[model samples]
Target: MDGQRDEGYVVVVNSEEQYSVWPQGRELPAGWRETGERGSRESCLAHIDEVWTDMRPLTLRREMADGTGR
Candidate 1:
């Protein structure tokens, strides 16, 4: 399958803001919600790369923000 013209994918995010590509028109797993961006898998992954700059999970980020993660 061509990356540019595949079955299509949707960008989904969890509470941690971690992103992943899910099959378009399929039910997302629990705790994951669509970021409203849908396109080729490559595009979805690119979107994840751009938006998920901080690789830390939400809880860890909060802890770091509170100066406790260290």
Candidate 2:
């Protein structure tokens, strides 16, 4: 946990035209519906705000080896 932590974001879109934004490397919870136009854009934005507000920060090790090294 002492190493520098990197942050990233991703937006997932499903066949139904619905989507959810999540911290890039993590999996969305089971049964969490990620897509649909059921809610307005404002609602979706608000939901994202609410969910990310409480998410714990993630720490990751850097992958420094390049193509030559691998």
Tens digits of per-residue lDDT for model 2, 3-55: 31333444454433344755444576664444432344445566666555433
List candidate 2 stretches off by more than 4 Å.
1-7, 28-70
**Residue 58 in candidate 2, Cα distance off native in Å:** 34
lDDT of 2 at 30: 60
Error of 2 at 26 (Å): 0.6
User: Which window of ten consecutive residues has the lowest lDDT sum in model 1?
Assistant: 1-10
Whole-model lDDT values for every prediction:
0.87, 0.43
lDDT of 1 at 42: 81
| Model 2 lDDT, residue 54, Cα | 30
